[model samples]
Target chain A: MKFLCLECNTAMEFKETATPDQGSLTAIFECPDCFAEFAMHMNPWETQMLKSLDVQLGGKSEAAQPMQMVRSFLNQQNPDNLTAEAPTVSTEGGGKCPFTSVVAEAFQEPVEATGPVWTPEALARLERVPSFVRSMAKTGIEEFARENGHTEITAEVMDTARGNFGM
Target chain B: MKTYKDLPADGGSNIIGQVTQQVNRLQQRLASVRHIVAIMSGKGGVGKSSVTANLASALGLRGHSVGVIDADINGPSIAKMMGVRGQRIDYGDDGVKPALSPLGVKVMSMDLFLKDDETPVLWEAQTQKDAFTWRGTMEMSALREFLSDTEWGSLDYLLIDLPPGTDRLPNLVDLLPNLGGTVVVTIPSGVSQLVVKKSLTMAKKLLNAPVIGVVENMAAYVCADCGKTEDLFPSGHTEEMARQFDVSLLGKIPFDPRISIASDEGSVFVDQHRDTPAGRTLIALAEKIEAFFNHEV
Candidate 1:
C-alpha cells in the first residue's frame, strides 16, 4: 500500500527511526514534495496485525518481543500515572500479565471454548514446544477442537487435532 | 495477584494512541541530528564511554557538529567524562536542550537526570543490589525518552555510546536504524579481544551494519616526562584482531595517566590534553573517522 504524506498530500517515502528517547520505534513518512517528516509511534496492534498475516515485522524473535517499547511509549505521555503507580510497585499490586501482550496476534489468554478444560497434562505438553512456535500450536489445537465441537482437549483430542492440524 | 515485578517497569493498559503522539514528538525533536553512529564494546570496563567522549570532542575539534547519546542507560559515564557529570537538562516550550560540553559538543546521558554524582539511578522502584538487575527494556524506554525529549539542533554526526553488550539492548537496533556504522573499541589483551570480537560480530551479524573500524584504547602508555612510549600490549595482536574482523585498525589510543585523571575531573582527555601524544593520535583518529564518513577508503 502506498503511504501518502498527510500534510502535503504527496507521494511520501516511508521511513522509520527510533524516537530520541529510545522508548519506541516510529514509522516516519517523509514528503519529498514539501520536505515534511511525519512520525507515528509503532504500536503493538500493528505488530499483532502483521503476525496474523504470517508476516515478521523487523525480524525480531518472538522469545523477546517489542512489548516493552509498546508499553513504554504509552506510559511516557502519562507521567502523572507513573507517580500514582509508584506506590503500586509492591508485589501485592500486581501489574498486567506479561504474556498477554506477546506470542501471537490475538495476544489474549486461551479461552475455555465451553467444551472442555485443557488438563494440566495437556497444557504441559503444549508448553514443551519451543516458545516461538508453542503459541501457534496452542491456537491451532484450540481452533481444531472448538470447530469440531470438542469441549475439553484430552490426549485423544490432542492426537486428532495433531493429525488434522499443524502449527 | 500480580505485582509490578511480574510485568514491565511500566504497564500499557490503554494508551496506544497517546504513546503514538509522544513518538511523533520524539521524531520531530531528533530530526536535526544526522548520521547516528554507535560505539559499542561487548565486554564491560573497556573504556568505550571514555573513547566516545573523547571522540566526540575530537570530532568537534575537526569543526564538525557532533552530539553523543549515552546509550548505556544503566551505566552512564559519557556525561561525566565529557564535562557535564552533574548537569541537569533544561526542558522549555520546545523540548529538552542537551548539555553543552566544554568543547561545544552536545551530550545527553542518564547522568543528566541525577542530582549528584553519587546519586543512584534507582530506575527500578523496588531496587535490587546488583547493577545487572536494571532491566534492558526499562533502560530502552528511558533511552527513548532521552532521544525524543532532547532537542539537538542540527548536527553533523550523532555518536551513540552503546552499553556493553551485543544482545543486552536488542532494542537499540530498532531505535537507530540509519546508523552510519559502528566503531568497535577494545584494549590490546587476549581477554579484551575475545569480547571485542563479539562486539564486532554484533555489528556484522546482529545489527547487519558496517564496522567502521576499531580503536585500541590503552594500547600503550606514554611517559609524560621523557616522551618515551611503552607499548604495553604487542601491536601485532590488536592488528590481527582488526585483520581477522576485516575492519581497519583506526588508531592505538595511548594510555595517558592524565586521561583518566581528566575524565575523573569531568574533562574530555582529547580536549584537555590536546598537546599530548595520545591527544594528537586521537585527532588523527578523528580524521580517519572523517575519511570513513566520506566513504574514502
Candidate 2:
C-alpha cells in the first residue's frame, strides 16, 4: 500500500486518486524527496473490497451519513421512502482532513464510456426484470454484448445473452 | 530494502482506522440498549423467526422498549411476522427510522427494503460469477449497517433473529463481542436436536457466550376442536439435549394451529390467546429472559 522511491530511499505521500474505471481504482503517490509520482492500479475486486469496507481511499474527509453505505451502493432500493429526499450530511467539523478533495473526487460513480448502447426496446425489456437483479442482469448483458462484438444492444443481443446468464 | 513494517502507514488509506471507527459507532449505538439477545437455531424450519417475533412482542407487552433485527438478510421474516412489513422507514438525524410493529416494537429487516415478496436479496455487482468471494462480506456489511444505522433509541431489549446454520453465531460474535446471551431453539425430533446441539456447542464451548436456555418448539399438538394434547414428534429429546449441554430447558411450546394462522395474518398469538398453553409458555419465557438479565435464576 506504501510506495518508496528507490533513487531517493524516501517514503511517498498520497497525491490523488482517479475516479473508478470499470470498478477499478487508480491512486497516485509522489515521493516527498524526489517529487516523482507513481500510480497504483487496483483491480476491480480490490476496489470493490474497499467499497464493501466503506472506507475512503485517501481517508474519510467527512463523517458518513447514517446508512450511507447502503444508501449509496444498494442499487434496487425501495424507491417510495428511500428516495424521497437526500438527507443533509452533517458537516460539524467542516473537512478538517487534508485529503478532503481527493476523497470527494475519488468516490464519484464510474461512468461507462463507448460501451454498447441499449436500444429502447432492449431497455424496455430490461425494465420488466425484477428490480433487485436488474442491475446485475443489465451488466451481464452489456458484458456479453461487448464480448460478442455487438456495438449496439438490441432485443436480439439480449436473447443471445440469455443463455450465458442461464435465465 | 525497507520491509512492510518499515513503512509508516498504508499510504494514508487508514483502513484500520476506518474499521475501528465502524466498531466504535456500533458500540456507541448499542450503549443505550441494556441487553442484546440472539435467537438462533441451527436447524432450518425450527421457527426461530416466529419465536423471536413473539418474544419481542411479549417483552413489549410487559412495558419494555424492545427492538428486533432480522439478521437473516436473505430470508427475513421477522418484519412480516411482527406486522411491520411494507412500513415506510425514513432517515432521522440520528439514523434511519425503524419500522414500528403494532405492539410498538422497533423492527429492522432486509424485507423492509425489498421490492416485493417474490424478490430475493441481491446486491448490485458487475458480474455474478465467483460471487462467493465477496458475497459473505457484503452480507456482514449489511448486518453491520442494520445494527449501527437504525435509530433504536434507548431499548430495554434488542432481539436479533439469526438464520439457520452453526456458522451464524461466529459472525454475530464478531459484530457483538459483548452479546448478552443466546437462546437456542429446537424441536423434539432427534434430527432437529442433532443440529441444535452443534449450536449449543458453538455458543457455550467455542464462542463462550452465555447460553440462556433451550426452547423446545412444536413439542406437542394442541387440537382445536377436541382440546386434547398429543405428541407431535418423538417427544422428550429436547430435555435430554438440554441436560447434555448443561443448559436450562426454558419452555416447551405446543404446536397450536392458531400460532401459524396468526403469523400468516401478521398477528401475535400471545396477544390474542394469552390463556392458551402456548401463549402462557411464551409469556413465561419472556419473564425468564428478564430474570436472566437481572441476575436472578
Candidate 3:
C-alpha cells in the first residue's frame, strides 16, 4: 500500500498486514530516502488521507503545532486514551504556567487594582530585558519571594492619521 | 529528535516522596540553630578571617553563645588565629565537635581535617566539581551533622567564616538553611569597592538572606608617633554603597599592626586591645549587629 512520510513530503510504500497482535503498542516506520524514523498508530486509510492533504512528517517538521499533532496522533492511536482524565489547563496564578497567566492577568488589571499592574512602558521594558537577566531576576524573585520589580521604558511617536497636529 | 525515556520498570512511586521527606527532615534539623551568619569578603587579604574570629569573639564576650565554622576550605586561618592552632579534632559518636578557643567559641575548619599542614585540597571540576560546591557541601555536611547528631545544646549564633568573593560564599549560603544574614567585608579601595558590588549583587541574586552591611577593613591608618589619621585607601565608598543597597554601614576597621600581632598570637583584637580603634570598632559593630538581629535597630 502507498503511504507518505508525515515529517517529509516524500511518497512511500508499505506492506499491508492483518492486525496480527503486534506486541508493541507503538508503530515504527522508517523513511527510505531520509532514513528518518516515524512512529504513529494510524491505519493505512488515515495515513493515505494525511498524505493526500500533503502533511509532512519526521524530525522537527513545521507541518502543524506539535501539541496538536500529538493530540491527533493520540486520538488516532486509541480512542480510549486516558487524556480525558487529564485536568483542564488552568491559567490562574496557581496554574503550572503561572508566569504567562500572571503577566496576562497583570496586563488586564487597572493600575490601582488588587493584582499586579503593568503599563505599556512596563511591557516594553519586559521585552527590552535580556533573557539571561530576566531569568536571573525571575530566579531571585522566586528564591527571595520578592515582587517583580522591573521598570519599563516607552517613547511617544507621532501618528500618521494625526499628521502634524498633536493628539 | 525528541528523546523520551520511560520510568524504571520497578514502577515505584515512592522514590521522589521518600527523597523529599528525607530532605525536609534535614531542613528541620538544620533549622534548630537560632541564627547562622556567613562572614564574606569581596577580596582576599581584606582580613575576612580576622574579622570573623574577632566578631565571634566579641559576640562570645557579649554573653551570646556563638559557633564559628571556618568554611575556607583552601586557606583556613580561623583555627590558627583563634589560638587552637595544630590542635587535633576528635570525632565522637555524635560528630566532629569543633575545638574551642580560649574565649570558648566553638571553631571548625578544613585545616582540622587535613592530615598534614602542607596537604593541599587540589579540587577540580572533573575531580571535585567547582571549589565552591565542594567546600559548601563539606561545610553543610559538617555543620548539619554536627548540629543534628551532636549536643550543641541551645545556640544563639552560628557564624560561618566564608571564603572570599561572591563565588564560593553563595554555594555555602545555598546549603545553609535559615541563614540570619551576611556580613560583607571589603577593604577601602576602588578595586575592593567594585568587588564588593559584585558580592552585593551576588547575595541579592543567589540568596534571599539579609545583608547585615558592608564592613570596611583597612579604612585608615593612625600613626602611633604622629597620632594623626591617614586615609590608607579611598574612604566613604563602603558607607555610600551600603546606603545605596539599603543596608547598614556596620563600621570601618582601621589598619592596625596590633590586629595582625593579635591574630598571630591566636587571640582576638577585642581581648588584646580593648581601647584600640579596630577593637572598639568591632565592639560597636557587635552591638549594632545584635540590635539588627534582635530587631532593636
Please compute DockQ, using alpha carbons, for every candidate against the native two-chain complex: 0.02, 0.26, 0.01
> What range of 10 consecutive residues in model 2 chain B has the weakest lDDT sum?
B123-132
- What is candidate 2's lDDT per residue for B168-256, written digit by digit as tens? 77778779987899999998999998888888888886665799999999989888888899999988898889889889999999998
Q: lDDT of each model, Cα atoms only?
A: 0.62, 0.79, 0.55
Candidate No. with top TM-score: 2
Regions more than 4 Å wrong, model 1: A1-167, B1-27, B124-134
CAPRI-wise, candidate 1 is incorrect
lDDT of 1 by residue, B118-185 (tens): 54554311113332433445566667656755567899888999888788535766666556788889
Model 2's DockQ score: 0.26
lDDT of 1: 0.62
Task: Score residue B90 of candidate 2 by CA lDDT.
Answer: 82
lDDT of candidate model 3 versus the reference: 0.55
lDDT: worst 10-residue window of model 1 chain B: B7-16
Q: Write the per-residue lDDT of candidate 2 for residues A1-167, one digit (tens) a residue.
A: 67778888777888888866665688899888889998888886776666666667766455345555555455545544454333443333322222122224475532231247666678678879975467656767877897899878899999989977786
Sorted into a CAPRI-style docking class, model 3 comes out as incorrect
Extract clashing residue pairs from model 2. Answer: none
lDDT of 3 by residue, A1-167 (tens): 23455565554323221221211112345555776754546543343232222122221112111112112211111111122212222222211211111111211111111112223443344435553244233223222221333221122221221232342
Residues B1-297, candidate 3, lDDT per residue (tens digit)?
A: 211122121111122332233245335544557888888876888889999999999999999887887777567789888988666554343233467889988876656544356655432111222334233443434333333333344578888887776766555554565778999998878888788888888887777688888798889998888868999986778888888788888999988998899888897888878788888999988888899988997
Candidate 3 segments exceeding 4 Å error: A1-167, B1-28, B122-151
RMSD of 2: 7.0
